[model samples]
Target: MDATPPGWPEAVRPPGAPDWERTAVAWLFDLVPPDYRAHEVLRRYPVLLARFARDHVAAGLEAARSGWRTVRVELADHLPADAMAAAMTAYEREGARLAAAARGVAVVSAALRGERWVPRL
Candidate 1:
């Protein structure tokens, strides 16, 4: 069974779909070992993931507000437990999906750009 939680279909896609940079990050993450991914996530704690997602979205909105796409940092991990857990899970699931999607998108984008996907050393 696909471990994707509810609303995954709608949430997985970034607002404008995967941009080149995000697509690249997604691709890079795919080549990373599963154990490495788990280690990184555990190191950061699930709460950090949720906070990062919130800050990222808020930064995007703030950028729009100022007619720029720059993101600013805010206090992190202060959100309530229930909401934070939900957000964290959603973010984790979406991150995994995006990584896989990015690999696919990278291939397409590379073909369009007349390049090939090159894994970083």
Candidate 2:
């Protein structure tokens, strides 16, 4: 019953992957009760988000990194049935893109640092 969608193996970390929790915001997610987590990130982490956004903007950027600010919108419940489905499609598309990009960047960086293997053809 693994509900993971297809094309997600790129993002799934292998078992026993080195822990990075101390260096990332994923820990902020576990603070929310699962049933109540859906709309809680912005409400709970506004300070952190604001600081990050400010830092991103001060770097002479007009928008937050990766479009963070507009990511938390909540559409009214009155939308047509297809609206939620469309949203899900968009979310999935972005999620896949981000995951793939992260994997690509990490591998490239590791290779540059002599950590990832580079095969000769």
Candidate 3:
């Protein structure tokens, strides 16, 4: 029986499980820019790292959504019809991926904050 909530990242073990925080930190780091790895403060403070990861994921999700909303208007004239359609499809796929990443980040952030998931019937 897995205790992890839906959308919980596979890279992170369930909260309260052995080494879960360490795994969570590693997983969170993977979500952020590679440059974030150079920050000693973020590495020393997992909670702070989680916060940064949350914000970063949120920004990515927003960017994807914004691009999807405007790509047609911005590129319709410049791109062929098939290319424009492909761009829209690309945006939609990326937006969905980012949205899922956002959810995973939220769950990891909550766990890092000491929140535990309790399954309900």
Top model by TM-score, which number? 3
- The per-model lDDT (C-alpha) reads 0.40, 0.39, 0.87
How would you encode candidate 2's per-residue C-alpha lDDT over 1-121 as one tens digit per residue? 2232223233333222443212122322332234433555644553353333234323422222333334445454655658766665666665555454344334422322335343355
Candidate 2 stretches greater than 4 Å from native: 1-73, 76-78, 116-121
Candidate 1: segments with Cα more than 4 A from true spot = 1-78, 113-121
lDDT of 1 by residue, 35-67 (tens): 545557723443333333334444443434443
lDDT of 3 at 66: 91
Candidate 3, residues 1-121: lDDT per residue as tens digits?
A: 4498889988888888788889988998998999999999999989999889888988888888898899888888899999988888988998888788788888888878888888899
Model 2 clashes, total count: 0
Model 3, runs deviating above 4 Å: none
Model 3: lDDT equals 0.87
1 or 3, greater by lDDT:
3
Question: Clash pairs of candidate 2?
Answer: none
What is residue 34's positional error in candidate 1, in angstroms?
33
